[model samples]
Target chain A: MTGPHKERAVTHTRLDVLRLPLIGLLRRRWGRLALQIPLLAAAVLLVIDGFTGPQMAARNLATVAPWVHFRGFVVLVLLLAGNLFCMGCPFTLPRTLAKRLSIRGRRFPRRLRNKWVAIASLFLLFVTYEALDLWASPALTAWLIVAYFAASFVLEAVFTESAFCKYVCPLGTFNFVYSTISPTQIGIHDPEVCRACVGKECINGSYSPTPLVRLDDIPGGQCEVRHGPEGTPGCGTLLFAPQIESNLDCTMCLDCARACPHNNVGLFVRQPGRELLRPEAWPKRWDVSLLAISLAALGLVNAFGMVPPVYELQRALIKTLGIQSEWLMIGLIFGVGGLLLPFALALLAGALSRALARKKLSLRHTVAAFAPAFVPLGFGIWFAHYGFHFLIAPLTIIPVIQEFLGQPGDWAAFSSTADAVLIGLVQGAGLVLGFLWSLALANRTAARLYRRDAVPGLLPWALLLLALAFAAGYVFSLPMEMRGSLLMG
Target chain B: MSFFRLIAVGLLLLAAAGCRGQAITPTPAEKLSIEMAVEPDPARVGEAALIVTLTGANGQPVDGAKIGARGDMSHAGMAPVLAEAEGGQDGRYRIPFEWTMSGDWFVELTITLPDGSTMTQRFDVSVSGAGS
Candidate 1:
């Protein structure tokens, strides 16, 4: 809806003031280690809550989601501190626990590798959700949590590094996509400081406790562990800080930031939603594919709960697929919802890029640039679909509360019919708004690539795709709810 | 000068534009404006008809526009039905649904005016408690 700004005078004045000191402050790594632990604890709790709490509690959690409830505060924190989520990732606690068990020596098959197995597993999860009523099933929700822990623990045990978190984990992949819009990032103010340091300890994990080995009666020399392209020890997650031109791979893990001798790497605040505009920077197809999948999955999931046909399909899935177990449903739902849908979009984007470019952009690069655009769409559908349920579904509890205990209140008295109607209108409006936002973002990103007003060409097609998704959702959703209806009635 | 500043200015503009762009675009020519609402609350299932009204924004009463209603509880899906014709003015259409269960439901209405342009409206409804 808007164009890039070109106000020169104000921009020049601000740049002169910030350029040097901002660079200087970024190099200083004084209080980073002090702040990382607590942030990590919070992430762990969120993941834990995600499992123990309602699985599809999107609307309920919105009331308390750090981003939703405290957008201003969280934005301020992210702006000042670099990727605080990385600093306090509960995701790493299991890694530390694994290290203590000392079972990391065992490595998995090196050549027999295809990262898509993880993709397939997530895909299967979505399909199964449709098959078994995982949305309605709490135990299945618990199992998803268990699956995360077991998956992470086993992968780390075999991979000897944060391979699962870095490459294979779907939710991690999902986070990486959303985090692109995050104002805070891990980056450097000075390349020279990194060049002068004799040990280059940050990349090598300099201060890490070592095996007190005597090298010919001498003390400190070379590091025992090597990571990344240069065989640096510090970036165990395999991120090469210097080469990290984009935020895609940098887990915001402050190892390198803390390690650099010249106090560089300051996290600064920036504009929200700015990342969506800079389509040129997105480099990884895997990241894009993941994002696209995330968006499509949300749409599919939103539709998953809307159609009547799905109940019959689910019944048929149980009867015909012989996959009665929720675990299998989880696997199946994740497969379709998480993997296939996004992959299809990414593939389509690649095709569009190739057709539009009239040049062969490798499928990889096309997917990367195009895939991130879908994040808004995925997130939008989720907000719209869940917002409706959040507003309407809870009124049932009011009557239960009154009946179980002596109460004179009409259940509707507690929430009211007006409340339901208002919520529905709001939710429907929110969805349409989300759809427009996503469509706009998609058009903008695609325009930058296709180099014209892309919306006129793409809007209907994209809307058609969304409409198809909506219709398909409606078709699959109807019969399940209507099964009780008699033909005569 | 700095990349962040460029982003900042752009974001401020986007927020400003998002505020002003809320006007609903009227459906193109040869189309009808179909607005849908369900009575006694859409979320809680009681004996309430899925109410749909069809009218052309051009100040004309539009009728014979077949409206379909479906209940999708369990997020499963819906079985669509034509709104039974009752003695009424030409434009108004209502479909009664005795929803048996509760959860997410969607109702789709296809409105065909005399002008051959068909407007399809989809409304998603959630019902709670047993609908008689």
Candidate 2:
């Protein structure tokens, strides 16, 4: 109880991003829509190019933009900010429209409401991408975009309030998991304002009586009598600001900010991965734990597939197993890497953590509680992988754009030695930073759970993190196969 | 207005714009026309394929043609995989080559016609993984 270790209250400082004028602009009703329109237009153009333009993957917009630019920027933004891509997602626009048309609004099934569906979808996405060589087939990539739109439209048309984003959508899950370490998050400016408000407008949209209409007479309105119009709606995922803990389920749509009648919601800056340490704030669920660990494993798996060893391994498996279809072989690889291996590691770690903790916790609870700690390392691997592609061929987009515009241009002319070295260094630094952050989160979780005997609880998880870090480092060291890019073979 | 209603209107506009298809003009014909078919239908990585047939302007097999074939991943930075063949019987030149990896490979066939005019045509081939 002496020195700096003496028990004392720790004060947290937060910077309200809404205090800045630019955030005020983004919070407006049309703000997100304005940003989404251009993206939708780009999607439409990609589809057109995929269907009608040159079949060459390098020359097609569908193949280049999503695999190279979009994936790269998503990880970069998730690291720097919160889930900004989810905020401006164009796919949700159709869902919003379907809602307006009074499409049937049914609750998402309680049983299917966990992360299992998303996890399965994520695995399927990975397997399909590799099996079909989606990145090398512009037409298939284009159809994938169409499939996304159709799925969003159909899902939202039947269910109410962003079921596609919350319970489904692999990309959404990816963003949600990685954004645990994001520097920015939507938060309450003052908890007192939320306490006094009768209407939970942050989850349910704000409502007000129209000047001409009686409060009780407006049809389909929230008011007991009736209200003129349902004012601006709140969080699409039904997150209330005061109760919001982690970025786990949040899409960062900012509808919560728009629906706050008291202007109390604001985006705040805090220590990255702060939520992973706060187990009390989030519910410990088995599905989320599996999802987190699988994501971490899949991150390495995805990177591993591109290197030469995976090809050699696949060849060996083919010889040993006598499997004729490559899809089956790829599926076997995905099953081991994405599901079986990760689950085994999580089970072992959870067993150890339960054994060592001061308080008796269920194995599932212990695993779920500690799973968020793996996100930083998972995101680091992804960042390194996608960042390498982004850095080495940053200007690949220029020629792709030119080709899309019916102009002849050289997409292969963008690669160089110095750029590759610089990118490698940056990726290496990312891996190091990610590993350190994951270790810190693991330590924090251990200290919180085990108190005086934190070392025992921390040991197993630390080894897991170290292994993951080493795997990521080895992956980055390998010569990566840059699919769909002309600049990097 | 309900936020959904506003969004619905915006979606209508976007759908309209997205649905308006542009007329696709045909690309002008190239000076050299070469049709490449890999034997065994879908090519597999690490297996040899016989790429046969080279036709001239009149769509007939160009006899006595000197053909040089070079293959590489569509992406840059890798060393080129190459093969060459002169015209055999019926003006058909066969270049047997193997794909090192499973992905999109760009193959360039340079044909030196009987009249000494050289024409190069590039093609994209999808090579499947071994055991496919």
Candidate 3:
């Protein structure tokens, strides 16, 4: 704490900025449902409007809510706060219903209890969105929401654990990865308080009849005795308050805060993106590492799909390879450009890091340690693309909602800012900031790993990240083919 | 460099990208008025046509205007459909358009006057889910 004014830890102090008294409402048992109920109602309306109302994406609730507003807001909230999206997740309530009715189902298969499945699901989702043009189809978007709820119910009903949020659910997994960098997290007020407490109700729901504390649930969700009262629930994902290091798995459901008997767990604010720099922030697993890198790479592919160059690439590939199906070609791009190529780069970077540091650590550990450096850039690209839609068309949803409510909606109000220079510049700023954050994270991780050789070890990954940021910039600079009078070449 | 310095560099990059050049589209000096009639009275999904009555601000018919049309949904990312018009007598232009999906669409008319003067006008229309 003693340093020059410039070097003081004023900026780095892990003080609880968001104190317990500040978020008293959310710390209540049903606080989250107050938010979730409204969103669930909105989701239902979106589905109804998508299916039976106007089929136009812009005019329909399904297309506008999920694609534009939800996406933009999720990223914004994640970067600024934490996984607030999952706190009020509409699917969680329906999943809890399954938990209540199914009478404690069997445990999720041990072999299939990793991020690998979620990663695959996210990849498939990216491919489906582009190939099917899901963004433009309200019906399809509505169906997708319906499918998410159905999947949530079915998975929760069949599993003894909260398998859907932990091992499955691509959206949850995306939020989990990005949440690592968010500022606020569910944490204990004092370690001594947690150490002295016998009934760890944070992970174990506050059940009636002197509820039993399931200590086994504190680590890996093995303690599965779901006999809690109707109103009370704990960390459904089985994350202990005291042991929770990052926002990687916690859903930010505030259930932990509600369930903590000691009143110790609250939304404490910490440094954003600093969690990723922790030496043991993430487990040294290949699936976790690959998931982190893939999302970043896939976001680029997703953004590239909206630009004009992608169509030209598709046409060229079709002509040269005689590919008949458009979906198949796009799938190839996603699989190779999005998944495999980035993975290959990650492997090379891992190898070079080991070689430079003269360390013989396993490649899996090296890659896993460095994977977090990629998250910010991926989030940046996503923010840039989704934010563009949200910012450029801020008044778009008003007209759509009006039309949905049986009023004569003014489409003339559906005007864009038409300020390409300003919006593009904003997009560029977000992206570059993300890239810089990633670079800083990489350097810090390297320093932790290789000490004196940190500079050399981080070189390869730095280059790869720089290339990614450059690609993102180029795509942002290009005339993106969009609705209205945007990029109409 | 320190973390803060890197962020400062990123902001600088934004300032640089802000100065990036933009394409300037030239507009013809004419305040033309256009009255559009969708072929099927109320617009519906499927094969549709736009019959446009074009007139100059000088209160005369703009004859033999080369009319090109581009149509897109009100949202971003969908591929726009382009079409050319068939010129008729007395500044009337007929452009065939298809509402592939039932939704809100905006169609921009690229009007090339007989004297090679070019102008553009955009119209927003809602298509009912009635036709094929």
Chain B TM, every candidate: 0.58, 0.69, 0.84
lDDT accuracy of residue A380 in candidate 1: 47
Off by over 4 Å in 1: A1-87, A105-118, A124-147, A198-202, A210-236, A249-253, A273-280, A284-291, A312-342, A345-353, A356-365, A386-489, B1-44, B47-132
Clash numbers, per candidate: 68, 2, 1
TM-score of chain A of each: 0.62, 0.90, 0.90
Stretches of model 3 off by over 4 angstroms after superposition: A1-22, A208-231, A483-489, B1-132
* Model 2 lDDT per residue over A1-489, tens place: 122211111112357776788777877767677667777777877887788776766556777788878898999899888898888888887776676577857988989988889998898899888887787777888899999988888888888768889988999999999898888777876554555555667787764556222232122333332223556666778776776677888988888887766666777787777777778655688888888888988989988888767867877886899866767877788889878988899899878877776558788777877788788888888998888766655766676676566565454464222356688888888889888988998898888878987898988898988998998798778655534312122
Please provide, for model 3 over B33-127, each residue's C-alpha lDDT reduced to its tens digit, 9 standing for 90 to 100. Answer: 87778888688767889888898898888777788786767564233456787566787878887765454577778888767678888888866
Q: Score the docking of each candidate (DockQ).
A: 0.03, 0.11, 0.06
Q: What local lDDT does model 3 show for residue A131?
A: 67
Flag regions of model 2 displaced more than 4 Å: A1-14, A207-227, A356-359, A410-418, A482-489, B1-104, B108-120, B123-132
Scored against the true structure, residue B105 in model 1 reaches a CA lDDT of 52
The iRMS of model 3 comes to 16.3
Tens-place lDDT per residue, model 2, B89-108, is 66566777877656667887
Residue A204 of candidate 3: its Cα lDDT? 66
Give the Å shift of residue B70 in candidate 2: 10
